[model samples]
Target: MLKRKLLTYALISGLSFSMGSSFVHADVTKLRLAVETTPGDPLNIMLASFRDTLQSSAEEEVELEFFEGGALGSESDLIQLLRAEQVQVLPIGSDIVELDSNFAIFDMPFMFADKQTARDALDGELGELLADSLREKSGLEVLAFGELGFRIISNSRRPINTPEDLSGLKLRTPGSATRILAFEMLGAAPTPMSLGEVYIALRQGVLDGQENPLSVLEEFSLYEVQDYVSLTNHVYTPITLTMSANSYAELSPDMQEHVISAAQEGAYQTRQLSDTSDAELVEAFTSAGVAVNQPDLASFQTASVPIREAIAERLDAVFWEQAQNILEPR
Candidate 1:
């Protein structure tokens, strides 16, 4: 009887140990990162760095999966997923923030003077402030800001040499209030559409033309459907790498630090690639039979001034002033 009782106790202990071990292994952290950019885009190159770094440095098996090319859905869809903890991370366009009016500050027309100005503002105090504000207000942690280059105008109608040339032309823009207003203020009809639908719409003539970074223009092969590529360089658009606050809080402290560091490195590498690859992208677009034009940017800048005022009224003057201070030379 004593031997049988001891045997039963041992069996129970072994079962409990086995169950605990299984639970621990099953709980190993796995992350699913989503990017709207295509596989060959610079953003993907940056994300690859993060995946590689996390895999190498993580103590446990940290499985990093990617959903690219809008497979996970539009930026807005992914943002909602992050809020619901349905996905882990998203490197999305700045326009995604238009869902909240406060985010419109980033989209203020001609906000950053040039790519260099954009980079400086993003990597400096302004970037940190914006990231913190998003975290506090939107419930997401901003890991780092990645560059998508300055937006350019492309249409089959004609070359957009000045704001006057864009008059009466229908331009496709993301569903951001600031962007719509910016295009309208510039005298173009702004049509808000999902990124996934853009290609078909452009091909079918459902839309007249679109504005995007050269990298995106090349990625979606927009150069094929469009004729003229104006280097408007009007808006310096930045993509944000964001993670869910809930998922972030669930991570171990060490893991959290590792992830944040990796994300920062990814953003830096992406920005570097964008800086170096612009010339190559322009050349590629030209070679593909797309007419490239570097217009008189001063006119476009002058036309967008009204857009800034309109946005400031809705987003607050303080936010606009702070952004300007960051962009202006110290």
Candidate 2:
């Protein structure tokens, strides 16, 4: 994939754009979008929609291509490539913490009420706050926001119906300190691991349980191994679509607007798709025989108070205040 992109880079490098022009006809600018989910997963489905939308809306102005299911690399590897300008755009899930720790605000336990509330916070000023951090700290332009859905806990050991049930269970979490801390506060032993290793770990008894949205449970087929799934909707994670600032800078202002607008449309599509798919995915998991149960949500929410305060003290105060203002609204 890198070689193909490099070749395309060379081919387009010689094409010169005339300044003050509203559009560029010099060469086709294909925005290569990367994600770690497989073809049927919501992200890929959204990417296909993104491609069609970009083609129809900007047929001559630009193009969009996708390398899904970790084809380019894990989100981490892809970020390095995005920084190097090897790829133009990639949708990131939790790894946004690595880009700007302010994003760790999302990992705070039991933050958003539901997918719609999460979308409103991100689509409003709060989203721009994190986007500003990324552009300033990482040279990435925030194109739009999508949904990873709310994360639920699934286990092989037994049912997790409360915070106490989580005690001593080795739960697989992303390699984020905030996530690990969240699990610890909820009385589970958080095991930080890459998503690729999770299935094998569960099969080998290396992990007791893990958490993710229903789509991921379906995508990874963890339901095949894990006997029980506890709907402990602890965190609502948003997928971020972004481009390298340098790439955005190189395009004519009008073309730049097109890329951002196309990405935003794709993101809006993904959010809508996710909202509709979550209930169906849950029902499918239940039919597949994965024990699904909703724990007392108030217990989980109450347990999160100190965890919120503790992590907030560790993160940038401005970002924390921004989150509070958006969620609670001035």
Q: Pick the candidate with the highest TM-score.
A: 2
TM-score of 2: 0.89
TM-score of each: 0.86, 0.89
How much lDDT does candidate 2 score? 0.79
Over 83-195, each residue of candidate 2 has an lDDT whose tens digit, in order, gives 76766777788888888888888888888887778888788888988888889878998888887789999999888877999999998998888889989988899998878
Overlapping backbone residue pairs in candidate 1 total 0
Tens-digit lDDT track for model 1 on 1-330?
476456545544543453342221354777877766677776676677777777788856577767777665556656665665656777767565654466676667677767777787788878876877677777888877887778888998899898899998888998887788888888889998876678888889988899988888887788888999999888777777778777787787888888888888888877887878789988988888888998988887787778888887886466657766766636
10 residues in a row with least lDDT, candidate 1: 18-27
TM-score of 1: 0.86
lDDT of each: 0.76, 0.79
